[model samples]
Target chain A: MSDSPIDDLIQTMGLMWSADGGPRIAGQILGYLLIEGEPRTLAQMCEALQISKGSASTNARLLEAKGVVRRVHPVGSRQDGFLAVPNPSHSLLKSVAKRLRVQADEISDISARFPDERADAQRRIADFAEFYRQSADFMDEWTARIGPARGETAQES
Target chain B: MSDSPIDDLIQTMGLMWSADGGPRIAGQILGYLLIEGEPRTLAQMCEALQISKGSASTNARLLEAKGVVRRVHPVGSRQDGFLAVPNPSHSLLKSVAKRLRVQADEISDISARFPDERADAQRRIADFAEFYRQSADFMDEWTARIGPARGETAQES
Candidate 1:
């Protein structure tokens, strides 16, 4: 805690990047947005993180693309507020669904490609992917029952 | 989904890389080891993965370091038994503990570094890390009660 908001933000970013999701600058941005529970302007974000204007732009855009964060526009104002998805757990549910669908497709393609040659291995892979979908669904239901991770403020959770 | 054992191994590696644990190459190795079930020689692993001999050695060493895979010596043989740890869910308990310990210490340092000036930001960062530890503890306990994942024979469901 360097007694500055900027230092704290940087520290949070470092911690998030060190986690499982990703070890990248964009991850840092998402972590900050997700945990802060506040909407911040682009300039404010850049200033707090002591990053260049261009770098902030790129990182913010990346976060938005991930669907974990979004750009919000205030009433009658040009300044954009970059806010994290209001419901972190629910968003994760959606992500799980999308990722599982894609993986299932991949597994299907793999099974088709190999035919009978590596049949056992291919079957196992597809089965595992299906299991993954089950696991994700399990998490979604669990979260819905428990709560939307601490800061999400989601109603259902 | 290719029936090719080799392709499955590669795809398995990619899946582990994207899983709940950090993106670990050692985990990739572990997945392949699990699929083979029977222990493999280091030479076989190197050939299948298409990596250099040195890469296989180093990566195997890394997997061994993580406690997710083991190097066992078969009876009456000098060569080691390259096998996965068998039950990964319990292993996750230990890994989560280690990761959370590091996170706790890092967040403590951040708290110390921050003065009273940026109290809100400092609080946000601290809580974010605190929640991660709480989540880890919860998941670990749940998994322990639920038994193992990744094809382990469940002791109890």
Candidate 2:
């Protein structure tokens, strides 16, 4: 166990993200970027986090795709760098809300195929679908109040 | 792929929950209980889900611990059974909210230890902590409006 506070934060994030089925290294990179508050080269990340170059590069791209981080061209550096986006938790929450909506759709689709005799199952399925749908809506409202996600315009279409 | 609707639902839940770092079998069992709408013996679960008795027993216990299901004594049956609680998704959401709160706490604790030289990191850490805290609060309010979780009283102290 490291006595460093930054290490503790990195490990906390790594564990949390891994628990959500995300790569632990991605969370660690996010943590590193969060505290460093600057764009970091892939090599710098590998050196600081003690991770392989390939792992750092892959997870950095993953985080970029998730909108939790953005790629940057660091001055006087050959390699591109990654920086944590402002309010990254919102981006992560937005992805979760999207999944909840998908789950709702899947339940609704399956529920439509039930036989007439399976009334109980139909009712239960409807309830489950509604819960997920409403949860997604709630999340949308919450994230909206927090402001637009990275690269998103505040103006409603 | 199976053309059965329940099978589709089960697979969907299995994938979703497993993606959230839960046991796939547990999600399958939850889906089974959701559509079945009744208590199921471990033997019946093993037979219908085609899972090993050990897997059925373990996952059932895990679900019960998560408050998504409850153990019950089946009439005229020596073996105990498990039943899905009403609105099990609420329980799952509640658990997620609790985790968000924990993350907020961890971030806050680490932020307090930052030195005067780390003003930028402190500001960013504060934003991250606030997002998690508010998100958790939003989830709690939403779940409360939806009604009490299984075994929870509606009355607030």
Candidate 3:
């Protein structure tokens, strides 16, 4: 109902990230930092987003851990600030690929324990494992290709 | 810990699917059906898995919707039996790719609404959109390559 474009965009990203298994608040925090394009203290984030200080802090830490956000400390200042990591697309893909690799390894190990009579089931599981492994490899290649752009952004910062 | 290998495998699959955003019970059901390699009635699944009838039914329906399970009716029987679909790896990958495509489209649309002054944010969003779009295309190509094997499995059934 609110006709604010920025607010709508933030809410949309929040929903998307929530669907991706992260907290909606973390997505909102990332959205805010991306659009604001500046380091913001926890207090400023809470004030601007009309969220509780605890919520802001918790989500900020979560996003930071996920490599989508980073902590910043201004010179001569005791308070910490947060900023969205530039070009987080590669990190996000890598995280997903890492999880898929874990799944693949787990399934492969499980299939190895199957009895000879269950060879069919074992083969099926192996196929699934192979699919995940290949997918992870593809993602790794993509991450490498994007590495240069990410490095350039880091240098600019 | 139970020394039952099959139980351990199903539990592991449940954990993986839970992480992938599906219900754990659905993953367990898929695991069970994959190993069992035969059509099973809802009652049989409930009794074998020691799960309640409600849980079995709900999870079975969920798996079926995800293309991981299929319901078959035995000739002259009123009850429906479920079997793990052949080559679910392709379906699973396709499902993930479809979801990513949807996310890419959503983010692309959001980026289009950004004001001209927010070009930096717009460009970042565009890059994220492209990454997801490309990932989806890669998955699509993989799925197509596996189509023949999937068809052979279907013919065997």
> DockQ: which candidate is best?
2
List DockQ, one per candidate, in order: 0.26, 0.71, 0.49
Worst 10 residues of 2 chain B by lDDT: B148-157
Measured as a fraction from 0 to 1, the native contacts recovered by model 2 come to 0.80
Q: Distance (Å) between predicted and true CA of A44, model 2?
A: 0.6
**Quality of model 2 by C-alpha lDDT:** 0.83
Best by TM-score: 2
What's the best-to-worst order under TM-score?
2, 3, 1
lDDT of 3 by residue, A20-89 (tens): 7778888888888877878889998888788999999999988776677878889998889898877676
Better of 1 and 2 by TM-score: 2
lDDT of 1: 0.61
Give lDDT tens digits, candidate 3, residues B29-147. 88888888888999988887889999999999877766778889899888899988766767677777888899889878888888898898788777767877987987787677666
lDDT of 3 at A57: 90
Q: Is the docking of candidate 2 incorrect, acceptable, medium or high quality?
A: medium
**Candidate 2 on B50-116: residue-level lDDT in tens?**
9999999999888887778878887788999788887766676688788889888988898888878
Fnat across every predicted model, in order: 0.12, 0.80, 0.42
Looking at candidate 1, what is the lDDT of residue A74?
Answer: 88
TM-score of 2: 0.91
